[model samples]
Target: MNALSVIDDLKRRFPNEPEYIQAVEEVLTSIEDVYNENPEFERYNLIERLCIPDRIFAFRVSWVDDKGKVHNNMGYRVQHNNAIGPYKGGIRFHSSVNLSILKFLAFEQTFKNSLTTLAMGGAKGGSDFSPRGKSDMEVMRFCQAFIQELWRQIGPDTDVPAGDIGVGGREVGYMFGEYKKMAREFTGTFTGKGYEFGGSLIRPEATGYGNVYFLLEMLKTRGLSIEGKRVAISGSGNVATYTAEKLLSLGAKVVSMSDSDGSIYVPDGLSQEQLDYIFKLKNIYRGRIREFAEEYECQYFEGERPWQHVACDIAMPSATQNEIDGDDARALIANGCIAVSEGANMPSTPDAIREFQKARILYAPGKAANAGGVSVSGLEMAQNSQKLSWSAEEVDRKLQDIMTEIHKQCVKYGTEEDGYINYVRGANVAGFMKVARAMMAQGVL
Candidate 1:
């Protein structure tokens, strides 16, 4: 009846995918006793069935390029759960995505959204379509075509998907416009829209900002602050940039950031001008990280990960999943990395997580750390439902509140036998309780 047993039983019964099972096992092993003690959840067999999705949709997305050529990609939608509300998650466009990854994300999202105290269930969908090197018109056309088939399976109050890797505001607009044209219902069908078109102003910066907010809370508990702390951030995308910005505003010196290729380190702390240049390179010009080093007059290491560069007080992994492995974790610990907060889904593998916990570093999982994105998405949903938009300051304040509340809940429920709080367990248990109660209240379908 323990949470570990619940996941272990799934692993045994399934006995098909070892990696996936191990991932679930790591999460469950963190909070096994809670599941064993919860009578309502146990009575419903929630733990055993929580890992399974309700429906999985797969389709082929074939789009023609401007050069009279056709390309086909596989798409997936995993509706992990909907007991509390509709499915809500992001669609990632990466070559590495598959059914297993999407299912893991959805399962994690079910808890992540619940932790935000938002009435959103869990689901994720995307294609293995790489948007890089494609023309704007080409990407738009693909998005339009992608949504054409996906429209039937989603709606405002049903399943809402936002953008992830290889997808952005333009793609969201194309998909939203297509969905509206097809359904003839202009509702909050999708989030991450442009601000003028029902997107929340803070949504773009929410995940990064939220990760820092959670970190600030963690530091506060230990009577520490981000002041003068050296921060090393991975990924030069929206999450990493905004996270570094927030940390900089809090008086922390951000020393390094990376992309897929390599990393850059500046001794005098990164400047806003450099970040503006980075945005132009990545968001506007779609350039690489090597260019980042050239413009900033910094040291660049090609074919090297960010964690191995140098020491820092805080480490934020805003990059893709499994970016920080055990080696990276050990390096961070050795280099005096005090806090590790994830701005991307499952950025740290199980081994990395174990290393961090063993080192007693303040660690926040992406589900809880990055909840700010969907938290603002929820705010967007409210604005759409009420036909009103709040000011940026108001939205940002609310976001801080949401992140702080999540931190409190995690700490409240995640206390370990040794009095050390495993944020992963705290996040999962806090989220699970809310969703399970909601599901129990709704009765089984």
Candidate 2:
């Protein structure tokens, strides 16, 4: 596959896109050996085709604020691939949203969807419109405006987008409303919808729960149990909150949770009451992590992450990408951490991932570990099509089963000769093979 050469060509073609380049480099490096083994793939020139998106929609989202002011923001949708099925991914709405980040996310989603054993391809879209400190009316108006430019490009059997950072049920609801009015039909155009509208029962908790579920399977391989394990989790949003909820129920001690403002640590681990308070604080009141510390009398580190500050047996990076670097990885390993299950996309830098792999700790990448959300989103599409809803228990059971299967794939492909499970290599290769075969059968465009 000439991995280095392909990367060099890409860097020149797509300059100033560190995140996208990093993502492509990682996947290509991992699958180079397998890709080169099959000459048919090269005959189709599939690597370059797979690396670029099929189409990207870029437009301006114009909305009016409560102050009667018009605001304009750039919005984008990158349809990376739809060879296997319809395009599927999430819409992020953070201020940090940019072409590089969205392109990287869409690239990663291509493989993540392949691993789910579901008929879904890959895409991603979002705007740089931050909802923080914005009024409900303003947020709704912005969401509606954002969809105005994207409604024509998406559909139930075409491309379905859920939610990601700075996007939630409320935002989805607003977008769905606008889409319904624009498209003149009601369909499962989006996942992560309000349950009353068509959202799956466990959709919100899927990613977080799936991460813990994957972690459990990893632990099982080593004859380890989650009970009594001290956990340090970053981020206090849906992923981290539900992860802590599931962990507490399974008898794990969660000692830390964080936000963009900082991290809070409870030496004895957070109780159900404490986590509930955090749920209200972050979700309902939209407060910061410092509020959790102030309310519970715990230590709060301002402008810091939880990895190096808190000692634990496990570290889950549930926040944004690159939140953990080499230093954080070393601290976690030195602090007796044995596993890292990512709840956020590409949360660990390359250097940090290398450290985790070198330490031989149980590490699951975000694509494999955090794929539950999209898994259930796929389920949501099924439910919407069948005009039926599954019970909470049914959805949860399916989620667990999906996670177990993903772990098995990682074990089958990622295990090194030295007996260390290189999950990164395993997940990348496993996901790539599925997409590669589908693309080959479909022939080159």
Candidate 3:
């Protein structure tokens, strides 16, 4: 029942896996007060059981490249917990994909899914394969090779894998096609599919649109609104772009967007035409953010994030984990930033989060704020099960409802004596209580 002691044991057991350990420590620390109050949880040893994954699958993926050269990559799927429902999560393809990262992701997914009120468990799968410069054919071949080892372990009613960072619509199509051939059934075994198939509407835009929805709710708590708020968002992927699109539509100004190379800061804010161009540049052309600067003659900071340099009312770190460190957090606070809604998993480091808490700024964690993507994925499963697809409006309405409910849950658990909401503590405790009760009821399976 001692959270630090449990963390010490985990650290000794998982010495080199900092990501996983960090994830566990964060949740355990946040929920320790409630966890200690429940003698049933301690008697059942739920913390130890919940920290470890139910199972992990690792395989070697061998695929041929464009020039007839063979490549080998390590593939992994960590099924963390399925006490609530079937295993569900995304399949990432990046050079940084590893057991530690996937485990951390899966652990977070457990609570994220619980917050959705959906029937899904936590799981994550990926390979250390980079698709940046690979040809379409080469990527297709790699997808097939990766699925050859994964197909048997996944299904629509079991573990449904969707797309992540390096895996997109194209990769999902390639892998789903291969899964169809291998399984000989055209079920919704995968999500984020093209509309030509059984894909749900608004699935692609769910995460970004949902992030803005949560941000608006947070702003409401302060008697403010998204209208005319200047925003700085990191990452040029789907989450960032569509978040900008949503923010622009709501009359908010999006001042910055970035990729791995650098950031483009448009002091005048980006127009719809410019955002369209960016869509073509990154999505269609696979180019960089620097191209935006070249085309629009804006300020481009080479090899720098958009955080420290941009002053805005809101900051959205849609990039990878640990992107915003203590320095970035300090700069954001000093520059008059008011709120941050994470669109990526664990994007803020511990120091950055502390700075935000100390400043008493409105901050939402990734698990609660970014649950829209998976929430819609759960909708996709429902539609597939019933053989029906909802319209875009229906899906959007459902996503907004889910994000609103998640915000309510955070407020329910996270409110303090001074009336300032500690959303991280709230989200962690709210999510953990649900899964913990479920685990206890399931009788330690």
TM-score: model 3 vs. ground truth: 0.99
lDDT of 2 by residue, 178-256 (tens): 9999999989999999999888998989999999999999999899999999999999999999999999999999999
lDDT of 1 by residue, 257-307 (tens): 889889998866787778778878888888998998886668998977689
Q: Give stretches of model 1 more than 4 Å off.
A: 2-19, 417-419
Scanning candidate 3 in windows of ten residues, the lowest lDDT window is: 436-445
lDDT of 3 at 322: 87
Off by over 4 Å in 3: none
Per-model TM-score on C-alpha atoms: 0.96, 0.99, 0.99
- Displacement of residue 300 (Cα, Å) in model 2 is 0.6
RMSD value for candidate 2 = 0.7
TM-score for candidate 1: 0.96
lDDT of 3 by residue, 1-445 (tens): 8889999999898888988988888888899989989998889889999999999999999999989999999999999999888999999999999999999999999999999989999999999999999999999999999999999999988899998999999999999999999999999999999988999998989999999999999999999989898899999999999999999999999999999999999877899999999999989999999989999999999999999899898999998988999999999989989999999999998889999999999999999999999999999999998999899999999999999999999999999999999999989998899899889887968
Q: Assess candidate 1 and give its lDDT.
A: 0.85
